[model samples]
Target: MSLYDEVGGAAAIDAAVDGFYGKVLADPLLSPLFASMDMTAMRRKQKMFFAAVFKGEANGADGYMRSAHKRLVDDGLIGDAHFDAVALHLQATLEDLSVPGHLVRQIMTAAAGLRNAVLNR
Candidate 1:
């Protein structure tokens, strides 16, 4: 099964996104970056993005994420430290939701792979 299916698909991704964002927004370093944004839309896009990534449907679409995050990178709002914090939040969210450890690692690895694009490095 695809990683998405293994992790319970859309519902699981949605829950993880919500849980993950809760921690992110509560974080001092990360919260400011999103202060002026539309969280509802951001959440929706995150769900879709995670769904695509886990399902392996993001082939050749690395630029999509990079472009989406270009503004944050240009503004110096995102960096390696911010990425690490986000990854930690994701790990915690998956664990909190009882997702398997191995699956969490896979998800994290996939996310890490996008770090360069996310940071525009």
Candidate 2:
């Protein structure tokens, strides 16, 4: 089965994204940067991200990196620490939901690839 099929598709990704942002916003270290925006849309984007990864494809996430954080990073509002916190939050959120081991590894590996694409500093 496709990893997306394995995890229950878009709905599962939605839950995971919601859980991740909840953890992030609740986190003292991570909440500040996200304070001004509605995280809902971002969570939707995250679900798309996960869905693509789980399906073993890359569909515009590269384009996303180009424009996605242009404003924030250009303003110097985000850096390595913030990225790491987000990664940690994602891991915890997935763990809390008991995502399967293989899927977890797939997500983590995909995240590592994106991390390279993300913070090019």
Candidate 3:
């Protein structure tokens, strides 16, 4: 089965997204970065991002990217440190859920690509 099938599609992705954001928001260093947005919107965008990722569809992710995180660096909300924290939290989340290492690596790699684009440091 493809990684997409292993991920259990949208329902699993939604659950994972919720769990991921819960971890992010609970971390003091990260929550403040999200203080300006409505949690509902964040949740929706996260679901969309995860859906695209696990479904092997990324073309539309740019819309969510633009809306959810385009200002991450510009607004001084995220930098290298924040990216590391996010990576750590996400890996822990996947580990906690017993997701396969391959799937986890895919997520980390994809996130790293975004991190490089934003941090550039």
Candidate 4:
């Protein structure tokens, strides 16, 4: 089964994106970065993006990730710490939702693969 399906598809993606952002926005280290963002739109985009990623439908995702976060990278607002924090939030969200451990590991592995591009490396 696709990771998306394994994780409960759209409804789960929606919950995860919301839950993840809630953690991020509440985090002192991450909140400032998201302060001016349009969270509604951001959440929508994230839902779509994560859905695509989990479904293994992300073509050209690395380039897209690079472009998407280039501004943050240029500003030096994002780095290993920020990436790690986001990953932790995702891991927590999956765990909170009771997704199986093996599936969570698979998803995290996929997310980790995008780290360089996300950092615009």
lDDT of 1 at 11: 91
Estimate TM-scores for all models.
0.95, 0.85, 0.82, 0.97
Top-scoring candidate (lDDT): 4
User: By descending lDDT, how would the candidates be arranged?
Assistant: 4, 1, 2, 3
Clashing pairs in 2: none
Model 3 residue 75 lDDT score: 75
**Which sections of candidate 1 miss by over 4 Å?**
none
lDDT of 3 by residue, 1-121 (tens): 6556787777767677778888999999999888887988878877776766766778755454545565676777777788899889888888877788988898888877776555633
**Worst 10-residue lDDT window, candidate 4:** 48-57
Q: In model 3, how large is the Cα lDDT of residue 105? A: 92
- lDDT of each structure? 0.90, 0.78, 0.76, 0.93
> For model 4, how does the per-residue alpha-carbon lDDT over 11-72 read when each residue is reduced to its tens digit?
99999999999999998999999889999999999999999888889999999999999999
Error of 4 at 105 (Å): 0.1
Q: Which lDDT tens digits does candidate 1 get at residues 1-121? A: 9999999999999999999999999999999989999999999999988888888898755798789889988988788999999999999999999999899889888888889888877
Evaluation by TM-score, superior candidate among 3 and 4: 4
Better of 2 and 4 by lDDT: 4
lDDT of 2 by residue, 28-66 (tens): 877887888767677777777778878878687756775
Better of 1 and 4 by TM-score: 4
The candidate scoring highest on TM-score is 4
Candidate 1 or 3, higher TM-score? 1
Q: Tell me how far candidate 4 lies from the true structure as C-alpha RMSD in angstroms.
A: 0.8
